[model samples]
Target chain A: MIEAHQISVKIGAQFLLQGVSLKILPGEVVAVIGPNGAGKSTLLKVLSGEWVPSDGEVWMAGRPLRTWSILERARRRAVLPQDSTLAFPFTALEVVLMGRTPHCKDLERACDYEIARTALIAVGALHLEARLYPTLSGGERQRVQLARVLAQIGDTFSIHPCYLLLDEPIARLDLIHQYSTLQIVRDFARAGVGVLLILHDLNLVAQYADRIALLKSGRLIAEGSPWDVLTPEVIQSAFAMSVVVIPHPYLGCPLVIPSPGPDLVPNSVDLIGRCKEKK
Target chain B: MGTPAYVLTVKSLPRRRRSISVLTILVILLMAIVLASVGIGVVRISPGQIFAILVKQVGISLSRPFEEQQEVVLVAIRLPRGILGILVGAGLAVSGAAMQALFRNPLADPGLIGVSSGAALAAVSIIVLGTKLFGGLFHALGFFTLPVIAFIGGLGTTLAVYKLSHFEGRIQVTTTLLAGIAINTLAGAGIGLLTYMTTDVQLRSITFWNLGSLGGTTWTTVGVVAPFILAAIIFILQLSRPFNVLLLGEAEAEHLGVPVEPFKRRVVILVAMMVGAAVSMTGMIGFVGLIVPHLLRLMIGPDHRYLLPGSALLGPCLLLTADLIARTLIAPAELPLGIVTAFVGAPFFLWLLLQDRRRGKFL
Candidate 1:
């Protein structure tokens, strides 16, 4: 289990995360959802140990986060940032193979290559193996990066639990890719790897995540199963927008339909009419 | 899926084989250059005689007789000079590749990062004012004073540039390039000031050192430089995996289990040690680092496992070839090795920049 106890991350005069607490258990997919500037990404960074909380503790596998060596942590957890930058023209396969860095013995073992290729296949990026990473499209690059992180935490062979922390993993992906990506994450969780994802799409979160943690102004406003947290009132309080939560026609999960506020509705229509008048 | 797996395994095998062949070819080219460098100097020695001399030195007498004078020239002058050229060149190139990896920018070079200039400044200061300023320290260090001071200066500038361009754990690519320019300019001014303060003989040595020459190499100088460069190369070659991961960005490298900060610190120091030792012995030889690694990457791809060792092999071939041209171009009048490298390297760097611009990518 990965647990954050009363974590507060302060940068200069502002608090990015203030006294927020959360936990992720093995074999569960937890989605962190919030509007812009809600500290969703900050929370992910803190949990991944990329940034230390100004106040509070993060415990991973019953050990204090700071106490774990980077290699040990890397073997048990993998992080995928929102966007990756690689100026060098490394082939996509090479990039994915880097995920095997923590588990690499002396030279890269042949099985490591097998694991990396399996990861690329899992992300449906095996065809892009020979293409240079810099030449890949935004969505393709994200997939390759995802594959890299997956390759880092190998299969379920480990007796120790592993975790995957992702920040907006499906942002650049198209609808089909978004669904497939979420499905992969869900399957990974089903295989007993804990997954913590920061997602903006509430409906996808509803369908895929076992639970949702809604954040607003660095505080966890709601935390429960999707059915419990995806209520109109909770979402309205977090996003400050009117939303109607209806059952998915097929999937039976919450389908949130956001309605624009009263003032903006007429203003948008007026702007369209004004543009016609100008024409 | 099964077929694809088999094909993928088959596809990777040739690349590994090709990399090994590339290294093999570089090794052969290096040997040819070593022989050409040692034999083709002012008093030409034939390859066979050179071979016999080497055999004799190792206590294996060859059937062919060679003159003692020929042996003297081969063993005393050309041999040490050849060894120095290879060491300095390989050191500069490997460090250049390492720097590029460290900065995660293709254009990063020892010369661009102010390491060479910083070493030049320290060496110049020692030459012009060492006896007067720190006479006691100079006497104690004796032969090592210049290289040691130069190493400190190189290490100091590297740390400064590294620290300045880093924000939190991220490297600011533009800021790093800009800081390098600033330090290079400052070091240049310091070298210039020291140049003004020099006596006539000191002035000549400083000019020669600044321009870079291997004409002064002896067994003692080779002894001084070899340990540092060899140690640095050995250490850096082992870091191929970490350096490859580092190209993904610092945060990504850390996520992959590299202790990014400490790894970066160690790399900076090793690069400094390399540039410092090389500069101390042979002055500022530019572009061997930049050109060799960049060219090799174009051929072998940017896998540092191949790239680092490839640079080590190719760097010597380039520097030794350049040294040959420098010494033989004017025949004893001698051009500076730095000038030879810059003549080729500067235009190559400009072309690289233009290429990047054409592709619309700067960082």
Candidate 2:
């Protein structure tokens, strides 16, 4: 399990994350959802050990996250940042192989290569293995980066239950890839890896995430199973907008639909008048 | 579905094998160039005589008595200069490759980052203000004073740029570039100020040194700079894998367990040391660092494991060729080494930019 206990991150005078607490358990996917500027990415950064919180601490497995060496921490947790810009023309295979860096003593062993290949296959990016990264589309690059993070902590040699933290992994991906990528994450979760993803799509979170944490103004406004956390009041309070919470017809999870604001409601008389004028 | 054809093709022959073959070929080419460079200097020495002289230096008695003057010329003058050329070339090239990787921008070079200018400023200060600043200690340090001061200046400027560019543990590329520009301009202004204050003889020496030359190379100078260059090269080679990982971006590298901060610090220090030592000895030799690594990247891809070593080998070859031209182009009245390199390298760089533009990509 990975746990952030009352962690607060301050950048100068502004508090990016304040007294936020969350825990990710093995064999589950936790989705962090929030409006813009709600500190979702900052929370992920603090949890991933990329940023040191000003107060409180993070514990991974049995010890404080700071107590572990970078390599040891890496073996147990992997992070896929929101934007992984590759300026160089490295092939997809080479990019995937880089994930095996911490594990291998030398360049790479056959087993390491096998693990990377397996990751590429898992992400449905086997075709991209030979293509230059610069040539890949945004969605394709996202998948390749996902594969790299997977290969990092998902090595068959690792016996510990690992954690994968992805910040907006599906932001640039198309609908199809978004679903497929979440499905891949779900599979990893089922295999005993804890997966935490910061997502904008509440429906997808409802479909895949076992639990959801909603943040508003750097504070956790709600946290529970998706059905419990995706309540209309909670969504409205966190997002500062009205939403209709309904159960999905197929998956039976809570589906959030935003109500149109006053400005967006079209007046039938005005619309008809404009149409007549155009004619 | 079956496996993809591209995967199968890539799996058939590993890319590592291809990179290794390319590296081997480059090493061989470097050797050939070194031999050719050694033979074609001011007084032409045949390949056979060069070999005989090398063997004789190793304490092997020759069947025919080698001419004493020729032996002295070969061993004493040309050999040290040739070796120094190799060292400076290799050092600058590797530093260039490492800097490009560190900044995650191909335009990043040691010269662009103010390392060369900083060294030049320090050396120029020593030349112009040595008597006033150091008094009697200037002569006491002898030939060592300039390089020592230049090394400190180079290292200090690099650290400043690095610190200025780094924010909250992340390296901001634009800030780094901007800081480099700021430092370069400041160093250039310092050089200009020193130039204004110097005597006529000091001004001439400053002009000549700023233009750069390998004419000042001696065995003593080569011996002094060799360990730093060798150490930097080996250190960079060892860092090749981490540097490769770094290309994925800093956060990604960290996720893969690369201690990015420490790695970056070590790389900056080593590059400063190598470039400092090279510039202090040979003055400012531009473009070898910028061009060699880039050209090698084109040939072998951006795998730093191959790119770093490839740069090391090809950097020296390119430098030796440039030095040979610098010395021989005007004969007894030699052109500055920097002019020869920029003349060759600037055109090649522009061609590379045009090619990239034609391809609809801006590196």
Candidate 3:
């Protein structure tokens, strides 16, 4: 389990995240939802120890976060950013091999090949192993990065509890791959990994997330299961839009159907129906 | 969690790094260049005489009356020049590789941090002013003070540039480039001022120093630079894997266990020292640092294990050839070393830039 205690992050004169705290348990996939500049990414960064919180602390498996070195932190937890660009035309397998950096026997050693190759198979990108990473499409690149992170954690799946913090993992993915990526996260949690994924799509959060954390202006506005926190009134107050909340057709979780923004006049070319198709 | 897994990966990586295989070719080429350089000079001694003189000098007794002219030309005149070529080439190239890695810029070179300007300014000062100071004081310290003053000047200018580039505890690329320009321009004006005040003979010395030449190579200059150059090369090579980690970006490198800030500081210091020594000895040899490593990267890929050492060998081979032309092109009239280096380095660098563009990571 991962827990934070009044985590506050201040960069220079501005507080990017302030006194926001939450807990993520094993076998749970939690998604934080908010508009742009709502501290969604900042909260994830803090929890992953990519950015240190200026106030309070983070605890992992009952141990304080800062007590461990960055290498140790990386070995136990994995983070995948929205987009990453390699400077060279590295092979997709080479990109995945980088995930084994933290797990290498010595700091001077290279990656473990067997573990890296196995991780590629786990992500089902084993066929693209020889393809150039930069030449791959966006969805393919994201999966390769996920594969790399999996290699870093190795088979420690049953031993060391790994926390996966995915920042906008599929913001640019197409319809089919979006659900496929979500299924990978769901499977990870089923194997006892705790995932705190940042997603803007409320429907995907509603369909998959076991718990929900609502953030606004760098603070935790609310936190609970989808049914308790994803209310139409909460959505209206946070995003300044009306929404209709109802049970998912199968999952029984709350669904947010957003009304148009206050000033956005309804155009004849509407987008709601096509967006609902994704759910 | 155990050491066994990492040992397997670490051992395998070296094999992959060594599989480039061209290193053996480069070593052979360097050896051939070294022998040929000793054989070819104004006197045009035969290869046999050159080999005999080299062996005889190493205490292998010969039956014939020692060829005084052949030994002097081969051992005293040509050998120093060849060694100087290798030292300057390897020093500049390795330093360039380090600078590129530190800055994460493929275009970075030894002179990026103002080492060339620093050396030039110091050498010019010694040529124009030191001849008057130590030349008038103690004649024993007269001829040598220029290199000493030049080294101090080179190191000082680099420190000044480093200070200017460092803002808010991080050295940003734009700031480094801007500071380099400022230092180079200021040093350029200083060089111009010194040139104006110098006598015609002193002016020639300053001019040749700026242009870079192994024309007047001596046993003493080679002795002064060779050990330092070898030491620096060893130091830089140790950082090869660390440099690969650094390519992941500073935050990521630190997270992966590299001490980024310390690495940056050490690299800057080592590059400054190597470049300072080279410039003080041979003025400024451009493009060896910029082009050699770049060509190596294209040929073998961006893995620094091959790139750094490959540049070290290839750089010397290229420099020796350039210097050979500089000495022999006009026959009795030698061209400046910088002229030949820049002439060769520019076209090669442009070709690399074009190829990088085709690869689509130019931006």
Cα deviation at A80, candidate 3, in Å, is 2.2
Among these predicted structures, which one has the highest TM-score?
1
lDDT against the true structure, per candidate, is 0.90, 0.86, 0.78
In model 2, pairs of residues that clash are none
lDDT of 3 by residue, B1-363 (tens): 222222232244433555367788899999988877777767777666766777786899665454588778777788888989999999998888887777777777766567788888877887677746656633664445555565567678767876776665445667777788788888889999999988999888888877888877898988777766788789889887668767656655654556677887777777777787788789988888988878777677666777888989998998998888888899888898899989987887678778768977543
Candidate 2 residue-wise lDDT, A116-205, digit = tens: 787888788988898999899998999999999988886642477899999999988887888888988998888888989999988899
- Chain A vs native chain A, TM-score per candidate: 0.94, 0.92, 0.88
Compared with the true structure, model 1 gives a TM-score of 0.96
Clashing pairs in 1: none
Q: What digit string (tens of lDDT, one per residue) describes model 3 on residues A204-253?
A: 99889999999989888989988877888788778878889888888787
The CAPRI quality class of candidate 3 comes to: incorrect
Which model is ahead, 1 or 3, in terms of lDDT?
1
lDDT of 1 by residue, A1-279 (tens): 999999999999999999999999999999999989989999999999999999999999899999999888888999999988898988898899899999875567787788888888888898998898999999999999999988888753266789999999999998898999998898888878899999999989999999999999899999999999999889878877788999999999999898867763457777898999999
What TM-score against the true fold does each predicted structure earn? 0.96, 0.93, 0.85
Candidate 1: stretches off by over 4 Å: A156-158, A265-279, B1-13
